[model samples]
Target: MIPAAAWGYQISSYPGTGGIWLRRAAVPHTGVVMPDDTDPANGPTSGSASSEAQRRTELGAFLRLRRERTTPEDAGISRGTRRRTPGLRREEVAQLSGVGVAWYTWLEQGRRINPSVQVLDAIARTLRLDRTERDHLYRLADIPGVPLDVSATQPQPPEHQTILDALIPLPATIVTARYDVLAFNDAYAALDPGLALLPAADRNVLWHLFTAEEHLQPLVEWEREVSFMVAQLRAESGRRLGDPHWTGFIRQFSETNGRFAEIWARHEVASSVTRRKSFWTVDGDEISVIATGFAMASTPDTKMWIYTPDDARSQRLLGLLVGRYQELGPAELLRRGARTGGAGRSSAH
Candidate 1:
């Protein structure tokens, strides 16, 4: 699950992370996140101290304001009658959020420290933040929040499926800048049959290209197409340099595929472009396509890629492929699609 605030996901109030949340190892001690001011990357790093510093300071103040306004009764807690300050104390917020005073102090003080998504969600809930306020808090922190529940995020509209299906013979699919395949037509499924077999998370073009899935084939200009994909991904990665999910995708691919790691290390960059592309099927058949894209206005950084048959042979093949899909139907196709072990071995297993 990813942050809902940025990706149309509703804020989740899950009390636990459900899986392994932290990296490395967990320390059985309080004040686990020791403050380090020397690390330039510790706090926001936009060059403008006024802007970044102000954002962090505002974030701290915002948390403080919420804490001060909410009474102990609202938080379902009480500290006998000796309390001097109004609302819950700094220590109380930390304790309620399952964090330490020292760590939360730095967070509240706008110090250089990164808070985990779970911790932020906990804090937001403790402060009784609404969806809009949660979004604001994440924005102030310069962090894209992930919803604890996958369902917290919205799904593609029913009309999108109809739009995809209407493309008929033309192989078309909607994908994010990250090449995450959101929706596809029957022709697309026919052209790249392996796509429908994978789980939702593995429904990525990059994953399909490198994995044991037979999605990749002999191309017209050798491996230039794949190289272009890598370059394009690198170019778009600038939008989310420290994003966990984006970084994890790169890390997993780099760890698993040597060629991918090598290409990624080049730092080459490219953008999406219309071009004539050719692909060879496992059956030794070739299909040429004129690939064009249409931006989806409703979904940010998402576009529809349409592959039109460029040659007579391709046109015939595409028609045959669509017919094949129709004959098998969705139910039969799904029944035949078996799940594979994804990009890498999950840490959980």
Candidate 2:
């Protein structure tokens, strides 16, 4: 919630985020790396990883912001006559939280140190953080619970598929923390090749952005959307620290997609959010969609994305796209694709 989990809350052609993340984006990787997860999901890595560094930086900023907002009187501390600091002092926060002053100072400086859960709890108490703030703190600290609701990551519950289909004209999909498309409706497939039309292996938001040959053509705000997407990935990495899935995913693209590799090196982090985006249809139609993200309390490993048109014109355009897909249907489209020997490639083919 604090790292802007609803996401610095944004916009694009689509808003089917789980908040608006992948579906509506026009193109390019956001170049954000999940932070401070060098611990590796199974084992720990050096504290020097870029993502970890970025997480630490965010943690420090969050702490400082909270600290600044809290006053001495608010913390039940006596305001001495000669007070100069606007809020409680660093030592005061450290002392109240039962942590070392130097350590807290380093934490604020964004140093490469791990803050335990207990310590974070104490700090949270000292800062009087609310539930959302507390969650954001834990995430930035790279604590294990940051991923939230770690359950079965695959073959999403049947009900979820039903929900996506029900969304109708809206494009929607379910995505993993790492941006893998778990499930999507026909509307989502209508958006692009990777949303649902592509083979399961290529059904990843990051993968499509990085490897799709014609990605640049569809994306209008390549830099902004790409940066936000990467930031989301970076924030999520904090939770999957040692998971091989994340490790392999990053490594594979780093080697296969040069631009992705370059952007991944940036190690950016962002909170999950909802927003609008615009994309160029294969027929050269420009459609703006609102992307919204919803959390699945039933499972933390997955999220739902729903995309709505941003205006009447886009709505009509979406209906047209949906009508085309409905007329042929995914199966018919697939069959046609196979006949043309372009089944797994982009529909634009």
Mind giving the per-residue lDDT tens digits that candidate 2 earns over 104-150? 76678675666666677789889999767887898898767542322
Give the per-residue lDDT digits (tens) of candidate 1, residues 1-349: 6553323111132233343233221323332343333335575444675576787789999999999988899999965768886888887888898986556766777764567666777899998987667767878877753332221124788898899899898889888777788888888877666666566667877767766433232354446777899999998877666556678778989999998899899999998899888755323456899999899876656789999999898999779757867788643543443232222221110
TM-score of each: 0.61, 0.52
Model 2 per-residue lDDT at 70 = 91
Question: Residue 20 lDDT in model 2?
Answer: 39
Steric clashes per prediction: 5, 44
Q: In model 2, which regions exceed 4 Å deviation?
A: 1-153, 215-218, 329-349
Question: Pairing residues by index, what is the TM-score of model 1?
Answer: 0.61
Instruction: Give the runs in model 1 whose Cα sits over 4 Å from its true position.
Output: 1-47, 57-92, 102-136, 143-155, 213-222, 281-283, 293-301, 311-316, 329-349
Q: With candidate 1 superimposed using the best TM-score fit, by how many Å does residue 343's alpha carbon deviate from the native?
A: 30
